[model samples]
Target: MNRDPSGGACAAEQLVEAGVRPTRPRLAIMEAIRTGATRHLTPEAFHRELADGGVHLSLATVYNTLNHFSEVGLLRRVGFGDRSYYCTNAAEHHHFYDEATGRLEDIPGAQPQVVCLPEAPPGMEIDGVEVIVKLRRSRQYPR
Candidate 1:
Protein backbone atom coordinates (compact mmCIF):
# COMPACT_ATOMS: atom_id res chain seq x y z
CA MET A 1 0.00 0.00 0.00
CA ASN A 2 2.78 2.41 0.85
CA ARG A 3 4.96 2.72 -2.22
CA ASP A 4 6.68 5.59 -3.96
CA PRO A 5 5.01 6.04 -7.33
CA SER A 6 8.28 6.80 -9.08
CA GLY A 7 10.49 4.44 -7.12
CA GLY A 8 11.59 0.84 -7.65
CA ALA A 9 8.38 -1.04 -8.42
CA CYS A 10 10.45 -4.00 -9.58
CA ALA A 11 12.04 -4.42 -6.18
CA ALA A 12 8.64 -4.31 -4.60
CA GLU A 13 7.36 -7.06 -6.84
CA GLN A 14 10.39 -9.21 -6.13
CA LEU A 15 10.00 -8.78 -2.42
CA VAL A 16 6.41 -9.92 -2.64
CA GLU A 17 7.28 -13.00 -4.66
CA ALA A 18 10.08 -13.73 -2.21
CA GLY A 19 7.45 -14.05 0.53
CA VAL A 20 8.54 -10.92 2.32
CA ARG A 21 5.74 -8.75 3.55
CA PRO A 22 6.16 -5.37 1.91
CA THR A 23 5.49 -3.22 4.92
CA ARG A 24 6.13 0.49 5.00
CA PRO A 25 9.42 0.10 6.80
CA ARG A 26 10.48 -2.73 4.50
CA LEU A 27 9.54 -0.64 1.47
CA ALA A 28 11.62 2.24 2.70
CA ILE A 29 14.54 -0.06 3.49
CA MET A 30 14.26 -1.76 0.09
CA GLU A 31 14.02 1.54 -1.74
CA ALA A 32 17.19 2.87 -0.17
CA ILE A 33 19.31 -0.27 -0.50
CA ARG A 34 17.84 -1.19 -3.88
CA THR A 35 17.73 2.15 -5.75
CA GLY A 36 20.32 4.26 -4.00
CA ALA A 37 23.59 5.65 -5.27
CA THR A 38 25.42 3.69 -2.58
CA ARG A 39 25.66 -0.08 -2.94
CA HIS A 40 27.62 -1.34 0.07
CA LEU A 41 26.07 -0.29 3.33
CA THR A 42 26.20 -1.45 6.91
CA PRO A 43 23.07 -1.93 8.94
CA GLU A 44 23.82 1.12 11.04
CA ALA A 45 24.27 3.30 8.00
CA PHE A 46 21.15 1.92 6.38
CA HIS A 47 19.02 2.53 9.45
CA ARG A 48 20.53 5.98 9.82
CA GLU A 49 19.31 6.92 6.38
CA LEU A 50 15.84 5.62 7.16
CA ALA A 51 15.73 7.69 10.34
CA ASP A 52 17.23 10.75 8.66
CA GLY A 53 14.55 10.56 6.02
CA GLY A 54 11.92 10.55 8.81
CA VAL A 55 10.99 6.96 8.19
CA HIS A 56 10.35 5.38 11.57
CA LEU A 57 12.39 2.16 11.49
CA SER A 58 14.63 0.80 14.17
CA LEU A 59 18.13 -0.40 13.55
CA ALA A 60 17.20 -3.75 15.01
CA THR A 61 14.45 -4.25 12.46
CA VAL A 62 16.75 -3.28 9.65
CA TYR A 63 19.34 -5.78 10.83
CA ASN A 64 16.76 -8.52 11.19
CA THR A 65 15.24 -7.92 7.81
CA LEU A 66 18.58 -7.66 6.08
CA ASN A 67 19.59 -10.99 7.60
CA HIS A 68 16.39 -12.54 6.35
CA PHE A 69 16.83 -11.04 2.91
CA SER A 70 20.34 -12.42 2.70
CA GLU A 71 19.17 -15.87 3.70
CA VAL A 72 16.46 -15.73 1.04
CA GLY A 73 19.04 -14.75 -1.62
CA LEU A 74 17.48 -11.35 -2.13
CA LEU A 75 20.81 -9.81 -1.10
CA ARG A 76 24.46 -10.76 -0.84
CA ARG A 77 26.98 -10.12 1.89
CA VAL A 78 30.32 -8.62 1.02
CA GLY A 79 33.56 -8.39 2.97
CA PHE A 80 34.88 -10.72 5.65
CA GLY A 81 36.08 -8.58 8.53
CA ASP A 82 34.09 -6.45 10.93
CA ARG A 83 33.32 -4.09 8.09
CA SER A 84 30.21 -5.60 6.57
CA TYR A 85 28.17 -4.52 3.58
CA TYR A 86 25.11 -5.69 1.71
CA CYS A 87 24.17 -5.52 -1.95
CA THR A 88 20.96 -6.42 -3.73
CA ASN A 89 21.81 -8.95 -6.40
CA ALA A 90 18.54 -8.97 -8.32
CA ALA A 91 20.65 -9.31 -11.40
CA GLU A 92 23.05 -12.23 -11.59
CA HIS A 93 26.52 -10.68 -11.55
CA HIS A 94 29.56 -9.86 -9.52
CA HIS A 95 30.36 -6.77 -7.45
CA PHE A 96 33.25 -4.41 -6.86
CA TYR A 97 33.66 -2.95 -3.40
CA ASP A 98 35.84 0.10 -3.09
CA GLU A 99 37.55 0.01 0.26
CA ALA A 100 38.96 3.51 0.31
CA THR A 101 35.49 4.97 -0.14
CA GLY A 102 33.66 1.98 1.32
CA ARG A 103 31.33 1.61 -1.61
CA LEU A 104 29.91 -1.30 -3.59
CA GLU A 105 29.51 -1.22 -7.37
CA ASP A 106 27.93 -3.89 -9.46
CA ILE A 107 30.01 -5.61 -12.09
CA PRO A 108 27.76 -7.13 -14.73
CA GLY A 109 28.24 -10.77 -15.70
CA ALA A 110 28.92 -9.64 -19.23
CA GLN A 111 32.50 -8.55 -19.00
CA PRO A 112 35.12 -8.27 -21.71
CA GLN A 113 37.32 -10.72 -19.83
CA VAL A 114 36.04 -14.22 -19.19
CA VAL A 115 37.68 -16.70 -16.85
CA CYS A 116 37.09 -20.40 -17.26
CA LEU A 117 38.37 -23.24 -15.13
CA PRO A 118 39.26 -26.41 -16.98
CA GLU A 119 39.14 -28.72 -14.00
CA ALA A 120 37.51 -28.85 -10.60
CA PRO A 121 39.44 -28.77 -7.32
CA PRO A 122 37.88 -31.98 -6.02
CA GLY A 123 34.67 -33.75 -6.96
CA MET A 124 32.70 -30.55 -7.38
CA GLU A 125 32.55 -29.73 -11.06
CA ILE A 126 31.31 -26.16 -10.98
CA ASP A 127 28.82 -23.92 -9.34
CA GLY A 128 27.91 -20.27 -9.43
CA VAL A 129 30.78 -18.07 -8.30
CA GLU A 130 31.40 -14.33 -8.15
CA VAL A 131 34.34 -12.01 -8.04
CA ILE A 132 34.55 -8.86 -5.88
CA VAL A 133 37.12 -6.36 -7.00
CA LYS A 134 37.85 -4.20 -3.97
CA LEU A 135 39.29 -0.93 -5.13
CA ARG A 136 41.27 1.89 -3.63
CA ARG A 137 42.78 5.11 -4.88
CA SER A 138 46.39 4.84 -5.89
CA ARG A 139 48.65 5.91 -3.04
CA GLN A 140 51.84 6.30 -5.00
CA TYR A 141 52.67 8.73 -7.80
CA PRO A 142 55.80 8.24 -9.86
CA ARG A 143 58.00 11.19 -10.43
Candidate 2:
Protein backbone atom coordinates (compact mmCIF):
# COMPACT_ATOMS: atom_id res chain seq x y z
CA MET A 1 0.00 0.00 0.00
CA ASN A 2 3.00 2.25 -0.09
CA ARG A 3 1.97 2.97 -3.69
CA ASP A 4 4.22 0.44 -5.40
CA PRO A 5 2.49 -0.55 -8.62
CA SER A 6 4.07 -4.04 -8.63
CA GLY A 7 1.03 -5.46 -6.78
CA GLY A 8 1.38 -8.20 -4.13
CA ALA A 9 5.08 -7.57 -4.20
CA CYS A 10 5.71 -4.68 -1.83
CA ALA A 11 6.29 -6.84 1.23
CA ALA A 12 8.49 -9.19 -0.75
CA GLU A 13 10.23 -6.20 -2.25
CA GLN A 14 11.03 -4.88 1.19
CA LEU A 15 12.45 -8.27 2.11
CA VAL A 16 14.79 -8.21 -0.84
CA GLU A 17 15.69 -4.63 -0.07
CA ALA A 18 16.62 -5.78 3.41
CA GLY A 19 18.92 -8.38 1.84
CA VAL A 20 16.56 -11.25 2.55
CA ARG A 21 14.82 -13.66 0.23
CA PRO A 22 11.33 -12.61 -0.78
CA THR A 23 9.70 -15.78 0.53
CA ARG A 24 6.04 -16.30 1.33
CA PRO A 25 6.47 -16.88 5.05
CA ARG A 26 8.77 -13.90 5.40
CA LEU A 27 6.39 -11.65 3.55
CA ALA A 28 3.42 -12.86 5.59
CA ILE A 29 5.28 -12.38 8.85
CA MET A 30 6.37 -8.96 7.72
CA GLU A 31 2.78 -7.99 7.04
CA ALA A 32 1.77 -9.20 10.47
CA ILE A 33 4.50 -7.19 12.09
CA ARG A 34 3.60 -4.09 10.11
CA THR A 35 -0.12 -4.40 10.82
CA GLY A 36 -0.07 -2.23 13.91
CA ALA A 37 1.04 1.36 14.10
CA THR A 38 3.67 0.35 16.62
CA ARG A 39 6.72 -1.17 14.98
CA HIS A 40 7.65 -3.26 18.01
CA LEU A 41 6.97 -7.00 18.00
CA THR A 42 8.16 -10.17 19.70
CA PRO A 43 8.51 -13.44 17.82
CA GLU A 44 6.25 -15.18 20.32
CA ALA A 45 3.53 -12.55 19.84
CA PHE A 46 4.04 -12.55 16.08
CA HIS A 47 3.67 -16.34 16.01
CA ARG A 48 0.39 -16.09 17.86
CA GLU A 49 -0.93 -13.54 15.37
CA LEU A 50 0.14 -15.68 12.42
CA ALA A 51 -1.54 -18.70 13.97
CA ASP A 52 -4.71 -16.73 14.42
CA GLY A 53 -4.64 -15.97 10.71
CA GLY A 54 -4.33 -19.73 10.00
CA VAL A 55 -0.82 -19.28 8.66
CA HIS A 56 1.30 -22.32 9.50
CA LEU A 57 4.70 -20.63 9.50
CA SER A 58 6.93 -22.59 11.86
CA LEU A 59 8.34 -20.82 14.89
CA ALA A 60 11.81 -21.57 13.56
CA THR A 61 10.93 -19.75 10.36
CA VAL A 62 9.66 -16.82 12.37
CA TYR A 63 12.84 -16.64 14.42
CA ASN A 64 14.94 -17.03 11.32
CA THR A 65 13.16 -14.26 9.44
CA LEU A 66 13.45 -11.99 12.44
CA ASN A 67 17.15 -12.71 12.65
CA HIS A 68 17.51 -12.10 8.95
CA PHE A 69 15.84 -8.72 9.24
CA SER A 70 17.96 -7.90 12.26
CA GLU A 71 21.11 -8.95 10.49
CA VAL A 72 20.30 -6.67 7.60
CA GLY A 73 19.56 -3.70 9.90
CA LEU A 74 15.88 -3.73 8.99
CA LEU A 75 14.96 -4.68 12.54
CA ARG A 76 16.34 -4.31 16.05
CA ARG A 77 15.97 -6.33 19.22
CA VAL A 78 14.85 -4.61 22.43
CA GLY A 79 15.04 -6.28 25.78
CA PHE A 80 16.05 -6.04 29.39
CA GLY A 81 18.21 -8.67 31.06
CA ASP A 82 17.15 -11.80 29.09
CA ARG A 83 13.66 -10.93 27.83
CA SER A 84 13.86 -10.15 24.14
CA TYR A 85 11.58 -7.91 22.09
CA TYR A 86 11.65 -6.87 18.43
CA CYS A 87 11.20 -3.62 16.54
CA THR A 88 11.61 -2.31 13.05
CA ASN A 89 14.60 0.00 12.57
CA ALA A 90 12.96 3.01 11.01
CA ALA A 91 14.18 5.02 14.00
CA GLU A 92 15.54 3.26 17.09
CA HIS A 93 16.79 6.21 19.14
CA HIS A 94 15.65 4.84 22.51
CA HIS A 95 12.85 2.98 24.32
CA PHE A 96 10.67 2.99 27.44
CA TYR A 97 9.14 0.01 29.18
CA ASP A 98 6.06 0.11 31.37
CA GLU A 99 6.56 -2.27 34.26
CA ALA A 100 2.91 -2.44 35.29
CA THR A 101 1.42 -2.85 31.81
CA GLY A 102 4.23 -4.61 29.98
CA ARG A 103 4.11 -2.07 27.19
CA LEU A 104 7.07 -0.72 25.24
CA GLU A 105 7.31 2.84 23.93
CA ASP A 106 9.83 4.37 21.57
CA ILE A 107 11.88 7.32 22.76
CA PRO A 108 13.11 9.77 20.17
CA GLY A 109 16.54 11.47 20.33
CA ALA A 110 17.87 10.07 23.60
CA GLN A 111 21.52 10.01 24.54
CA PRO A 112 22.53 7.96 27.56
CA GLN A 113 25.41 8.64 29.92
CA VAL A 114 28.40 6.41 29.19
CA VAL A 115 31.13 6.26 31.81
CA CYS A 116 34.59 5.03 30.87
CA LEU A 117 36.69 2.69 32.96
CA PRO A 118 40.05 3.78 34.30
CA GLU A 119 41.95 1.00 32.56
CA ALA A 120 41.36 -2.25 30.71
CA PRO A 121 43.55 -5.09 31.91
CA PRO A 122 43.00 -7.15 28.76
CA GLY A 123 41.81 -6.73 25.20
CA MET A 124 38.24 -5.51 25.11
CA GLU A 125 36.05 -3.14 23.15
CA ILE A 126 32.84 -1.46 24.14
CA ASP A 127 29.84 -1.45 21.85
CA GLY A 128 27.08 1.15 21.81
CA VAL A 129 24.79 1.60 24.78
CA GLU A 130 21.33 0.00 24.99
CA VAL A 131 19.28 1.92 27.50
CA ILE A 132 16.06 0.42 28.87
CA VAL A 133 14.06 3.01 30.75
CA LYS A 134 11.71 1.13 33.07
CA LEU A 135 8.59 2.96 34.23
CA ARG A 136 5.65 2.09 36.47
CA ARG A 137 2.25 3.56 37.26
CA SER A 138 2.12 5.29 40.60
CA ARG A 139 0.03 3.38 43.14
CA GLN A 140 -1.63 6.47 44.56
CA TYR A 141 -4.87 7.42 42.83
CA PRO A 142 -5.81 11.02 41.97
CA ARG A 143 -9.30 12.11 43.13
Candidate 3:
Protein backbone atom coordinates (compact mmCIF):
# COMPACT_ATOMS: atom_id res chain seq x y z
CA MET A 1 0.00 0.00 0.00
CA ASN A 2 2.74 2.49 0.86
CA ARG A 3 5.17 1.30 -1.78
CA ASP A 4 4.50 -2.14 -3.23
CA PRO A 5 0.96 -2.85 -4.39
CA SER A 6 1.39 -6.44 -5.51
CA GLY A 7 1.25 -8.01 -2.06
CA GLY A 8 -1.18 -5.48 -0.71
CA ALA A 9 -4.21 -7.06 -2.41
CA CYS A 10 -3.38 -10.58 -1.21
CA ALA A 11 -2.74 -9.23 2.23
CA ALA A 12 -6.10 -7.54 2.11
CA GLU A 13 -7.78 -10.86 1.39
CA GLN A 14 -6.07 -12.50 4.33
CA LEU A 15 -6.95 -9.62 6.63
CA VAL A 16 -10.55 -9.66 5.50
CA GLU A 17 -10.79 -13.34 6.37
CA ALA A 18 -9.50 -12.43 9.81
CA GLY A 19 -12.34 -9.88 10.14
CA VAL A 20 -10.04 -6.92 9.68
CA ARG A 21 -10.66 -4.15 7.19
CA PRO A 22 -7.19 -4.42 5.58
CA THR A 23 -6.48 -0.76 5.20
CA ARG A 24 -3.33 0.52 3.47
CA PRO A 25 -1.27 0.77 6.63
CA ARG A 26 -2.55 -2.55 7.97
CA LEU A 27 -1.69 -4.21 4.70
CA ALA A 28 1.80 -2.75 4.80
CA ILE A 29 2.24 -3.90 8.38
CA MET A 30 1.11 -7.41 7.53
CA GLU A 31 3.47 -7.57 4.58
CA ALA A 32 6.29 -6.41 6.82
CA ILE A 33 5.68 -9.14 9.38
CA ARG A 34 4.86 -11.99 7.07
CA THR A 35 7.87 -11.52 4.77
CA GLY A 36 11.09 -10.46 6.42
CA ALA A 37 14.53 -11.56 7.54
CA THR A 38 13.09 -12.66 10.88
CA ARG A 39 9.66 -13.95 11.75
CA HIS A 40 9.66 -12.54 15.29
CA LEU A 41 9.88 -8.82 15.95
CA THR A 42 9.27 -6.21 18.60
CA PRO A 43 7.32 -3.09 17.71
CA GLU A 44 10.54 -1.14 17.38
CA ALA A 45 12.04 -3.77 15.11
CA PHE A 46 8.87 -3.87 13.11
CA HIS A 47 8.99 -0.12 12.60
CA ARG A 48 12.60 -0.39 11.46
CA GLU A 49 11.72 -3.10 8.97
CA LEU A 50 8.95 -0.99 7.53
CA ALA A 51 11.32 1.89 7.17
CA ASP A 52 13.98 -0.21 5.51
CA GLY A 53 11.41 -1.32 2.96
CA GLY A 54 10.45 2.30 2.21
CA VAL A 55 7.15 1.92 4.04
CA HIS A 56 6.56 4.61 6.62
CA LEU A 57 4.27 4.15 9.63
CA SER A 58 3.93 5.70 13.02
CA LEU A 59 4.91 3.82 16.15
CA ALA A 60 1.32 4.03 17.41
CA THR A 61 0.12 2.42 14.17
CA VAL A 62 2.61 -0.40 14.59
CA TYR A 63 1.44 -1.01 18.16
CA ASN A 64 -2.20 -0.93 17.11
CA THR A 65 -1.60 -3.35 14.26
CA LEU A 66 0.33 -5.76 16.47
CA ASN A 67 -2.42 -5.66 19.09
CA HIS A 68 -5.10 -6.27 16.49
CA PHE A 69 -3.21 -9.16 14.92
CA SER A 70 -2.63 -10.74 18.33
CA GLU A 71 -6.30 -10.35 19.27
CA VAL A 72 -7.23 -12.23 16.09
CA GLY A 73 -4.72 -15.04 16.75
CA LEU A 74 -2.56 -14.11 13.80
CA LEU A 75 0.41 -13.34 16.05
CA ARG A 76 1.69 -14.58 19.40
CA ARG A 77 2.95 -12.17 22.02
CA VAL A 78 6.01 -13.18 24.04
CA GLY A 79 7.12 -11.14 27.03
CA PHE A 80 10.39 -10.86 28.91
CA GLY A 81 10.47 -8.81 32.08
CA ASP A 82 9.35 -5.49 30.55
CA ARG A 83 9.95 -6.26 26.86
CA SER A 84 7.65 -7.97 24.39
CA TYR A 85 7.94 -9.50 20.93
CA TYR A 86 5.43 -10.59 18.34
CA CYS A 87 5.78 -13.86 16.50
CA THR A 88 4.03 -15.05 13.37
CA ASN A 89 3.97 -18.68 14.45
CA ALA A 90 0.81 -19.01 16.50
CA ALA A 91 0.99 -22.78 16.82
CA GLU A 92 1.06 -24.33 20.27
CA HIS A 93 4.67 -24.03 21.40
CA HIS A 94 7.12 -22.08 23.51
CA HIS A 95 10.05 -19.77 22.72
CA PHE A 96 13.77 -19.45 23.33
CA TYR A 97 14.82 -15.85 23.75
CA ASP A 98 18.52 -15.31 23.15
CA GLU A 99 19.58 -12.51 25.41
CA ALA A 100 22.95 -12.24 23.69
CA THR A 101 21.46 -11.38 20.31
CA GLY A 102 17.95 -10.28 21.26
CA ARG A 103 16.50 -12.88 18.96
CA LEU A 104 13.49 -15.13 19.53
CA GLU A 105 13.20 -18.63 18.13
CA ASP A 106 10.36 -21.14 18.28
CA ILE A 107 10.59 -24.25 20.42
CA PRO A 108 8.05 -26.55 18.91
CA GLY A 109 6.99 -30.22 19.33
CA ALA A 110 5.90 -29.95 22.99
CA GLN A 111 4.43 -27.22 25.08
CA PRO A 112 5.41 -26.71 28.68
CA GLN A 113 3.66 -29.01 31.16
CA VAL A 114 2.28 -27.37 34.25
CA VAL A 115 2.02 -29.75 37.15
CA CYS A 116 -0.41 -27.69 39.17
CA LEU A 117 -2.09 -24.35 38.79
CA PRO A 118 -4.10 -22.40 41.29
CA GLU A 119 -7.82 -22.39 40.84
CA ALA A 120 -9.16 -19.55 38.78
CA PRO A 121 -11.21 -16.81 40.40
CA PRO A 122 -14.97 -17.21 40.61
CA GLY A 123 -16.53 -17.34 37.14
CA MET A 124 -13.05 -17.00 35.56
CA GLU A 125 -11.45 -19.45 33.16
CA ILE A 126 -7.90 -20.41 32.39
CA ASP A 127 -6.40 -19.32 29.11
CA GLY A 128 -3.57 -20.85 27.10
CA VAL A 129 0.00 -21.20 28.36
CA GLU A 130 2.99 -19.16 27.16
CA VAL A 131 6.51 -20.02 28.25
CA ILE A 132 9.66 -18.13 27.30
CA VAL A 133 13.01 -19.68 28.07
CA LYS A 134 15.69 -17.01 28.05
CA LEU A 135 19.15 -18.12 27.07
CA ARG A 136 22.64 -16.63 27.07
CA ARG A 137 26.12 -17.92 26.53
CA SER A 138 27.87 -19.00 29.71
CA ARG A 139 30.93 -16.90 30.42
CA GLN A 140 34.22 -18.64 31.08
CA TYR A 141 37.05 -17.04 33.04
CA PRO A 142 40.75 -17.52 32.23
CA ARG A 143 41.96 -20.96 33.24
lDDT of 1 by residue, 19-38 (tens): 88888777777777655643
- Sorted on TM-score, best first, the list reads 3, 2, 1
- CA lDDT, candidate 3, residue 101: 83
Off by over 4 Å in 3: 1-9, 139-143
Residue 63 in candidate 2, Cα distance off native in Å: 1.6
The per-model lDDT (C-alpha) reads: 0.70, 0.71, 0.78
Q: In model 1, where is the ten-residue run with the lowest total lDDT?
A: 1-10
Among the numbered candidates, top lDDT falls to: 3
lDDT of 3 by residue, 62-90 (tens): 98999898888777887768888887776
Provide the TM-score for each candidate, comma-separated: 0.66, 0.75, 0.82
| True lDDT of residue 7, candidate 3 | 39
Pick by TM-score: which candidate is best? 3
Candidate 2 ranges with C-alpha deviation above 4 Å:
1-9, 108-126
How far residue 81's Cα lies from its native spot in candidate 1, in Å, is: 1.8
Question: Which residue pairs clash within candidate 1?
Answer: none
Task: Please tell me which model should have the higher TM-score, number 1 or number 3.
Answer: 3
Residue-level lDDT tens digits of model 2 in 15-38: 776678878888887776665555
